[model samples]
Target: MRLFFGLDPLAGDKRAIDSWRQRVATADGRPVPPANFHLTLAFLGEVDERHLEALCDTVDDLALPGTGELRLDRVGYWPRPGILWIGPAAPQPALESLAGDLGRAGQAVGARRERRRFVPHLTLYRGCRVPPPAPAEPPDLPFRFRGVTLFESRRGRDGIRYEPVAAWEGGGFSQR
Candidate 1:
């Protein structure tokens, strides 16, 4: 399955972000559904079904750091990828450590790791051929994720949806 590990933003934050996206983003790109929003910790790509159990176990054994709030105060656009996103203005150590740990755990289970440094951001739009204009008023969303979720990316009649297959909350494993 196409899978990834990520932090799911709380409902209030998601609503605020979606409202901001509607207010500021142009019609040029496909606006990401708020329900599908996430701050990716590790992109595991495709894993064999046979290895799913091992992958989950590997992730379960990880030592996750305590959760904290992330202040997402900047807007950014990638011209090459034709994407727009919002992210923290500065580095967040708690987030970085969690992501790094998850990346290693996924790799230990045979999932390929990204070669580049991790940038914590939640994608706002996709398919922008040109760079989007900066918002007149900058975003200042404070996000606190309750847990890390293992999400399955699925495409169906209604476009793409991210379904949480499992999650670790407060350092405890839980099925979703």
Candidate 2:
């Protein structure tokens, strides 16, 4: 299965994001469904079915961060990936630590370590030849990181879908 470690925004957060996204011009690329919006921590490409239990156990053992909040205040576009995204307006050390721990946990379960540094952002659109226009006024999208989730990436005739397989909720200090 194609699995990854990520965070699912709460329902209210998702709705706020969807509303903000409607204001952005995305005529150049396919808009990612609000249901699939996630901030990926580790992309564990494909793994044997036998490793699922081990992966979950390893992740659960890690020191998951507490409730961390950040504003999705900046719009960014990556020309290589041909996608646009929104991310934290400032540095989020707690979120970064959580991702780092998850990455180490994934490696312990035999998943390959990602070479690139982690950049916390949610993809807004994909498969674009040119980047979409950014909103004139940046969005005030305050998001709280409540938990860590293991997601399975599935592909069918419809499109790609992310299904949560397991999750570990946070019950620690709040960071803003």
lDDT (10s digit) by residue, model 2, range 1-176: 98888888877888889888887545488889989998998888887778888777766667775556678888888888788888887887877887888777777767788898888898988877975666766877977666777888999898999998877776422121
Best by TM-score: 1
lDDT of 1 at 118: 87
| lDDT by candidate, in order shown | 0.84, 0.79
lDDT by residue (79-105, candidate 1, tens digit) is 767889999999777778878888887
> What C-alpha lDDT, on a 0 to 100 scale, does residue 143 get in candidate 2?
74
lDDT of 1 at 91: 79
TM-scores of the models, in the order given: 0.93, 0.90
Tell me the deviation in Å of residue 81 in model 2. 1.3
